[model samples]
Target chain A: EPEVTQTPSHQVTQMGQEVILRCVPISNHLYFYWYRQILGQKVEFLVSFYNNEISEKSEIFDDQFSVERPDGSNFTLKIRSTKLEDSAMYFCASTPDEKLFFGSGTQLSVL
Target chain B: GIQVEQSPPDLILQEGANSTLRCNFSDSVNNLQWFHQNPWGQLINLFYIPSGTKQNGRLSATTVATERYSLLYISSSQTTDSGVYFCAVASDSWGKLQFGAGTQVVVTP
Candidate 1:
């Protein structure tokens, strides 16, 4: 079974530093998304990308955050300046249509 | 924006016991899915039932889209089933999913 693969299973960064989380979505999926779950909280959608452009984003996905599908295979989420509150498990998902599949997730920790 | 609510914030089941989980949404949805977040923080897809019913092994799910609610049934539970089960819904074909707080399950053997 093909699955979304995310790199850097765990990332540790200092507050105000930059971090980029990478993902390789299922080969033929058309829609891609980034979601985060704060410790002990529900998962929250951050942003969605399609056709190499952002389709929708939540308020939590503010200017500090950006996503890119550079090279058509790798999807990356960059946070320009991390904060302590950014410590959470970030998930990457892709869907051919209605059934969405999620990656193992990248745990980001900002000190 | 749609609201999703899950019942019984937490549940504890002994091995071989059966349990049911419920999820309610505020409005109509085009897509509904269930996920299990394990202790390792991996979100595992369990079901994608927007309507009707489907069964896989000892697990099954039913969604009444008109009533804006869904149910997940787990039979003969095991310790591996201990995790947080999340229900997510999307109003549009490719919209972002709205996830509920999730029901934490602890299946003790």
Candidate 2:
């Protein structure tokens, strides 16, 4: 079965540095999303992207966060300046309709 | 935002036993899905039953949208079935999913 794929399974960055997490959603899927889960916490939605625009975002997705579908296959999330609290597992998901496919996730660590 | 509650936060079952997990939502939903998060932390799609019933092997799910609840049944449980089961719901307007805390199941031989 076709699945969502993410790059840089794990990343470590300085507190004031930038990081970009990349994902390649299923080829035919139309909607894409970014979600994060802090250790021992529930998964939280960050933003949803469709038609090259952000459909919705949460409060946590503030000024420092941005998402882009620079190409037909690549979707990415960039954080301008990482904070210690930003350490978590970031998941990328795509849906052809109601069923969403999630990637293995990228573990982001900020120090 | 919708509220989702899952029952029996933790479960323990012996091999060959059966179990049923429940998910309750605070509002009407157009999409409801059940997923199993394996030991490696990968979310495995189990069923996308927005309403009615569907079955696959030893697993089955039923959703009564009007009643605002869904149930997942696991029969002939195995050690491989030990993991976290998550129930997610999307409201009638958008596809954004709000997930329940999940139930952790441990099946022993």
Candidate 3:
């Protein structure tokens, strides 16, 4: 079956440094999303993208974060300056409608 | 924002036993899905039952949208079924999912 794929299975960065997490959603899906899960916490939605633009975002998706569909197949999340609290497992998902396919996730650790 | 609550936060089952996991939501939803997060942290899609019932192998799910609750049933459980089961719902006009804390199930032989 076709699946969403993410890069940098694990990443470690210093606070105040910039980081980019990447994903390639299923080819036919039109909606893409970013979600984060702090250790032992429920997964939280960050943002949703459709039609090459952000459709909606949560309060946690503040100025420090941004998402882009830089190419036909690549969707990326960039954190301008990482913070210790930003450490979490970030998941990328895509959907044609109600059923979503999530990537294996990128574990981000900030020191 | 919608509130999601999952019951039996943790469960332990012996092989060949049966189990049922429940999820309750605070509001009406356009999307409701169940996922299993494996030991390696890979989220695997299990069921997308917004309403009614569906089954796959030893797993089955039923969603009563009007009641705002869903149930996932695992029959003759196996060690491989051990993991975290998450229930997510999308309410309001948009499709952003609100997730429950999840139920950690450990099946032993």
Candidate 4:
């Protein structure tokens, strides 16, 4: 089956450093999203992208975070000046319809 | 924002037993999906039943949109079925999913 793919299954970064997570969504899917799951916590929605523009974003998706399609196949999420609390599993998803397919996820740990 | 609540936060079942997990949402939804997050933290898509019923293998799901609830049924469960099952929904005619805390299922062989 076609699936969304995320890079660097695990990443360790220093606090205050910049980090970028990349994802390749399934081809032909127009809607994309980024979600986060803090350790032992529920998954939280961060942002949704469509038509190369942000459709909606949660408060957790603040100025420190940004998303870009960058090209035809790559979708990337950047966290500027990471904080220790930013340590979590970030998931990328895409959908052609109601069912959103998720990547395995990238585990980000900020020290 | 809609609220999602899942029942029986944790369950332990004998192998081959059948089980049902429930999810309740606060409002009408245009999207409802079931996901299985394994011990390795991989979120695997299970079903997308915003309404009606759908089945795949030993797993099946039913979403009653008018009632604002959905149910996932796992039959002949196996140890491989052990994981956190999440029920996520998106209202507002958008695709941003809001997730419930999830139901942790452990099927012992």
Looking at candidate 4, what is the lDDT of residue A54?
Answer: 96
**DockQ of each candidate's interface versus the true one?**
0.91, 0.60, 0.70, 0.79
Native-to-model Cα distance after best TM-score fit, residue B97 in candidate 3, in Å? 0.5
lDDT agreement of model 2 with the native: 0.93
Q: For every candidate, what share of the true interface contacts is present? A: 0.93, 0.38, 0.69, 0.81
In order, candidate lDDTs are 0.96, 0.93, 0.95, 0.94
Model 4, B48-78: lDDT tens digits are 8889999999999999999999999999999
lDDT of 4 by residue, A1-111 (tens): 899999989999999999999999999998999999999999999999999999999999999999998899999999999999999999999988767889999999999
Candidate no. 2 TM-score? 0.97
Cα lDDT tens digits for candidate 1, A41-64: 999999999999999999999999
Model 3: lDDT equals 0.95
Writing each residue's lDDT as its tens digit, candidate 3 over B1-109 gives: 8899999999999999999999999999988999999999989999988899999999999999999999999999999999999999997434899999999999999
Off by over 4 Å in 1: none
Model 1 interface RMSD, one decimal = 0.7
Report the lDDT of model 2 for residue B70. Answer: 100
- In model 3, the runs with Cα more than 4 Å from the true position are B92-94
Q: How many steric clashes between backbone atoms does each model show?
A: 0, 0, 0, 0
In model 2, which regions exceed 4 Å deviation?
Answer: none
